[model samples]
Target: MPVIKDTFGYLQDDRRVDRITLSHPRSGFSVEILEYGARIRAINFPHARRGPVNTVLSYASLREYELDTAALGAIIGRCANRTVARAHPEFQLSCNDGPNHLHGGLIGFGRSLWRAVACVDGGSPGVLLELQSPDGDEGYRGNVSVQMEVRLDSPLSFRTVVTATTDRATPLNLTLHPYFNLTGDPDVSIDDHELRLAAATYLPVSQDQIPTGEIRAVDGTPLDFRQRTPIGARIHETDGGYDHYCPLLPGSAVAAELSSRRSGIRLSVSTNQRGIQFYSGNSLAGATPRMFRARVGLCLEPHGFPNALNEPTFPSIMVQPGETYRHDTRYLFAMTQD
Candidate 1:
């Protein structure tokens, strides 16, 4: 059985909201999620050296999360990343991200409250977070039902499965937004983290930070993560520490791996999504009173490419009626040898 606990009390628009935490005792892994935004409040892992510590950046109060410009530990939905804009009024979306519709516009899933419940799937214990988006909500046409299941599967592994069904065809790309730091210390940066990716091709973004409809080879660019390398080795070369999508190569296999020598913790990421957005958290920190600073944590969001609604050559992100949209991501944690 999963150990469930009531966390902080959040006051949003006079509604008293509460955060819930589900933990696996044997693995020493815990995930805290909030009703507001169905967002992850914190992900606590057993540090090989530092005892139990939260690996993801987060805020202590709901007020800080209310002002969170960065997605933080949230379930980004309606669409995970940025959406395109057309000159025609009929095709225009909310301009929240400086002319783009980011994370489902101004009041996206990250800022909205969700219906949450505790559930046990099979023999594994988890939490089911649900949300119903009305037709035309966030400029999308459809009454969409989104469900996210966060499961703690015993020692050193957790799973996130996001599914949605809509009455109308619409762009539906859902993904996780967790700025992770394997190191238990919040003061230290993730520049020294060792990362390796199985992906070989990546989507190049324009100056506007939107994918340029180009799927380029990673062999010669700084986007290459085929071999294990220090994250900061070429981060300075990117516009602001990698924020582009790396489409997973053919076959069913592990997508990426991240390890930290400081804490002896290793995180292996596996996903079924076509694209993974690697962000170095360049624009993080300073947004909240929390310990959020640039370069401190990194996010690996696996899903469809950003602006896919407008890009034809990119992977299809349309969720039509009678069809189910599903994406699954897993994080396997292990302790490195001393």
Candidate 2:
């Protein structure tokens, strides 16, 4: 295993951006990351039928990635999801999504540059990226330093660990946003992918797509994926496509499982977070011709609940001085016969 580093592109300010690749020759598993947003450029894995296929949605050039609004394969931070307007009287943030804040405001971590370096973790090739957010960034109260390590844990598995520390109390939730197309083809939608999640309850949303602070059982609703089911099975039943949060059930180390029959590729998701956000890529609009349609990919985000700052009943996303916040998530891939 060797780590390769190259110049991706230059910013408008002429700052050099780098691209790092970690590859396992034997298993033919590779991951490409960019320093611009600490984003994942691509995840290439061996397919049963195809020689090697990229499992995540990616743009053609750095400019396309810079203009990406869907986040694509980037790291979202400061606050991963929406934080409703007026959520807190003391904390006022810039509203990017309608009247509420989405994915840490307009110039959030996902849109910022990070310093990255190649590293070795447990004899595995990895990249360590760090970003420093100044005080009053996006109207937050603290100067925060965050470190994210993307490691190739095994031939077919990759893991991410994010740790942060703030000088003042701040609402912090970071997660990697990667649109997965298990079929490895942008023309093929994820509608046929079979998915099962370890969730018994899900948070209901309001007309604005913000959580209503009510937790409902998924037993009879279309949100229920306790059993393996096709993504398109009950997608039409939702307002748009699935863009809800499911609280992970306890006692299980695994959070979700997704498989594509066309490529015979399966993905297992595991995380230490309390819940997972399942997005069906309903709003995706890619510059590529084959990726112009929605539902071409989907996202599984592991982090704290959305609008948790306003919901007292929900888990806290607050990080105080001297306290370190850490989140670990892993993605494992395999080839399945059926």
Candidate 3:
């Protein structure tokens, strides 16, 4: 574990964007992290290829558009998924009463500056970033403290552990927003990739992309991913293409698998959350290539139910003062031939 500054002068916003590099001698793997949003900038696996790199889309070079605001590879928290306004049916609190509160009312953890805490001991092979948000910072209750730890187990795997504590009782849901390009080709769409999710049903959304408080079966719908299927196969039938929440089976383990046939790269996602939101990156619009399209990339966000606070039937998102909120999600990368 080494804490180094930007040697090539590539880092902008020096005060907020400190870099943390982790290397495993035996595994031959290296990972680079930025403290701005506690974002994972790069992951290099030597066994897969000499310079094979996995990144959450490069927002670093986009001057007109701020990288932090995009929530590229940041720790999203306080509340991870959507909330139907700020009104909690049980709690009787209407915070942002209109339609829904998506990702902590817009300017969530992605936009805030996190405090970097580094540990270089050989025993602790990773760095932890922490942030504290006062009550009502984003129009929500409870003063919350968030900690995100990035650890490199080997060249092929990186684990992110996010834990939080709140002084006041409030709904808490957290997840990582990482844009992955297994092929490393920005122009390439994830349509050809094969995906399989262990979900029986998914929450349907309305025109505004808000959950309708119904858990519909995915057996005959476009949301089905029980078996391997090409991502683009049924995307055109969907409004903006798959942006629904898939309910995970009870317990903690690997929930889904995404594989790119062309590159023989496989990504396995494991988490403790009860649901996973599969977003196909339908909102991405690139100005450079002059190619405006949907489903450019895919996101498998493991989290609690969307709008759980307002939906009485959904799982509980409330975190009491003394209870510590702990959740873990891991992305394991491997090379295979199909």
Candidate 4:
């Protein structure tokens, strides 16, 4: 177990941006992260066939990330997804996503500076990143102290735990937005990637991407990822690719399983959260250096329902003053024998 610190780059005015690399030699697993946005710069997992693969989509330099608008490999906070207008009348959030506020508005946690510290525990090699949001920061109520701990457990496992404490009762949701392409090649499309989600129902969204009140079944629609299906099989059936929130049922708690046949890599996602949002990089154009193109990667975000604050029926994301918001998610990776 080794925790290595390096000067990644400077954000502005000689502001030293630091990065930490945690490696588990025995497992051949490593993760490099930057303090600027508490973003995961790269994830190296040893696949039986591929040797080592960077599972998440990211840029080679900090400059590209500073200019990145796609929210690549970053920690999203305040609220994870789009928040409806007047969702909470007291808040005036930045309307970056049409009339809705997207990913915590303008200065979201995904684009903020976080304090970093090295941690080498008996369990895993990791880093602890912390950030403080002011009372009225990003039009959210209450001052919040947020901490995200990223750990690499073994050969091909990454775990994250996000905790937040607010001074007052407020709606809060946090998620890691990581675009994953198991091919170990960014130039390839994920069209052939097969996926199965442990979901029987999904929340539909409006034209503006705000979640509708209706929770629809996946049995009849193309949203049915209940069975193993190639992503390209029904991608054309949907209007804007896969961008809906699928709520996990009692027996469907594993969340999702994605595999790329060409790479012989399989990813099983497990999380305690009730919902997972699957996005097929439909809106990406030139977001990254080489690996950024439509259908190149997919994001399986495990968290609470989007727009839950507006829809009372959806699981509440309220973090009380005395309570700490906690979320844990793990991605288990393996390579199938050919």
Candidate 5:
């Protein structure tokens, strides 16, 4: 396993972006990342029979969306979810209340430039992208340091590990936002895809799309995806389509699984987070007409409770001084003929 670095591309605004490539020869898998927030740019999985490699997502096209700072396939953090407008004594964070603080304030880890530190662990290849933010960078107190590791274990698995430390007490929630397309067809809608989430209840949101702090049962609701079902089956029944956080049932370790019946592609998501956000990409305003429609691509964001800062009863997002914040999420890919 070897870690290699190279210059990727610079935004028109004159920000430098670097690329890291990690390869696992045994598994015939490789991954590339852009140094901007250490975002995952592309993953290549060799066919089972040693055929041409199949790309999971459009890595190059992602740059186009970078114009708006979409943070595509980047590690988001400081606070992964929304925070209400107010101050919490324990966490020492102030919420604007105007809208929930999303993805670590507006300029989250995704938008920040990270220092690339290339390293290999034993025989495993990976790179650690580090960023240190001064206190109040995003209206949060305390200086925060974040390290994001992108590892290529096999062609089938890409692991993301995020760890952070703060000098003063603050709120911390972090997660990766990867836009996946198993079929490699960006224009194809995932409506026909089947998904199963290991959850019984979900947090409902208000008209403004902020969590109402109420945990509602998923049974008999469009939010239910406990069993395998087509993504588009109940999408229209909901507001613009699913965007709420699904709370996993007790003892459920496997957060969710998605499969493309046509491509025989399967992705199993494992996480320690308390909630999983099933975003149906309802807000995808693509530039081209051939781009997939809303609800075409789905996001299974493993994270802490959404709007946690506003709801006192929810899991605490506090990160105190001298304490380290850590979260691990894995997306394992496999192929089946079913």
Candidate 6:
């Protein structure tokens, strides 16, 4: 199917926003993307009874999207996750999350407008969104240019390839923040959803949610999803819910798998990143539009270790001059008999 473009709405600054639709005819699977944040507005998957159900949490209008704090289906950049505040003396990173950096500061890349162009890859429909971040824009060094190529690779499957280059040495980690409910019904929670991770160990965090520099095994812990298990089976044992990073075991192409028996929808995530952040939508209780509830959706973000800038033991996220940073991830949706 051809990509359809339409007006989404206008920003408070009077800037016009656009939405792009990429559809696959054979599977009746489609994706809608808003140019405002390069966000995935919706992922309509074919259902036996419902026809096409939006399996991802999204806002009703552009206004609600502008007021979004949950990240929704947006692309996070500059650095995907958290970083310790005041750790880097030379780089005065903006502290948006209570003296700590969260999701690339207050107005991160997810909140910025990106230039979109229609494109096709190997006969697959897609779009290319580009953004330029000047040095010191987010208290980071170097002017970085990023390009995200989103393509519908096959029936019920899509892929994203993000590439960036910096003029000076700077920390760069980018990831997509999409909340999935599988059931496609806002009134439903993902408590019964089955999940599995390709991780044998995970990073333990302190009270501030920063990694404590220890790579611990998931065995004997609720974080263990080495085998498929219910999401809420042991959620109560944690402080709130799962919000830790699990390092992906080497040679594992599939990072995570999620499925909902209620909807018979299954989602598999594959990425080249080293870890995945499993956020069970702990803070979705206060989200806007009144349709949100805690645990109604979950986020599986694949990126580098958080606070890598502060932890010498963690792998570095720095990209030197003339070096191009690249990260690729794929999402496949299918129906399950069970």
lDDT of 5 by residue, 1-338 (tens): 45677777786677778878787767756778877766777766566654534433344543563653344667777776566644454343434335455677666787777878766744468888889988877777889988888776655787788888999877777877776666666677878888899999998887767788788999899878889899889888988777788888767767888888777778888887887888777766552223445554567788888767667788888888889888888878888668
Q: Which candidate model has the greater lDDT, 3 or 6?
A: 6
lDDT of 2 by residue, 88-167 (tens): 98789989989999988998998899988546633478989999999999888899999999988898999999999999
- What's the TM-score of each model vs. the native? 0.94, 0.96, 0.88, 0.95, 0.89, 0.97
By TM-score, who's the top model here?
Answer: 6
Error of 5 at 260 (Å): 0.3
Every candidate's lDDT: 0.81, 0.88, 0.72, 0.84, 0.73, 0.90
Off by over 4 Å in 5: 49-65, 86-98, 121-123, 286-292
Candidate 1 vs candidate 6: the TM-score winner is 6
**Tens-place lDDT digits, model 4, residues 64-167:** 77788888888888888888856676667778778888888887998898988557744478889899998888778899999988888775687888899999
Kindly report which residue stretches of model 3 are placed more than 4 angstroms away from their true locations once superposed: 1-14, 47-50, 61-69, 89-99, 121-124, 286-293
- lDDT at 83 for candidate 4? 87
Runs with alpha carbons beyond 4 Å of true place in candidate 2: 121-123, 286-291
Model 5 C-alpha RMSD to native: 3.0
- The clash numbers for all candidates, in the given order, read 2, 0, 3, 0, 4, 0
Model 4 stretches astray by more than 4 angstroms: 121-123, 251-253, 286-291
TM-score-based ranking:
6, 2, 4, 1, 5, 3
Query: What lDDT does candidate 4 reach at residue 312?
Result: 82
Candidate 3 achieves a global lDDT of 0.72
Tens digit per residue, CA lDDT, model 6, 1-338: 45888899999999999988888867778999998879998999989898999999988799898888888999998998889867887788999989898998888898999878656633478999898999997799999999998889997899999999999999998889999999999778888999999999999988989889999999999999999999999999999998999999998978999999998999999999999999999889776455498999899999999989888889899999989999999999999876
Against the true structure, candidate 6 has what lDDT? 0.90
**Weakest ten-residue segment in model 2 by summed lDDT:** 284-293
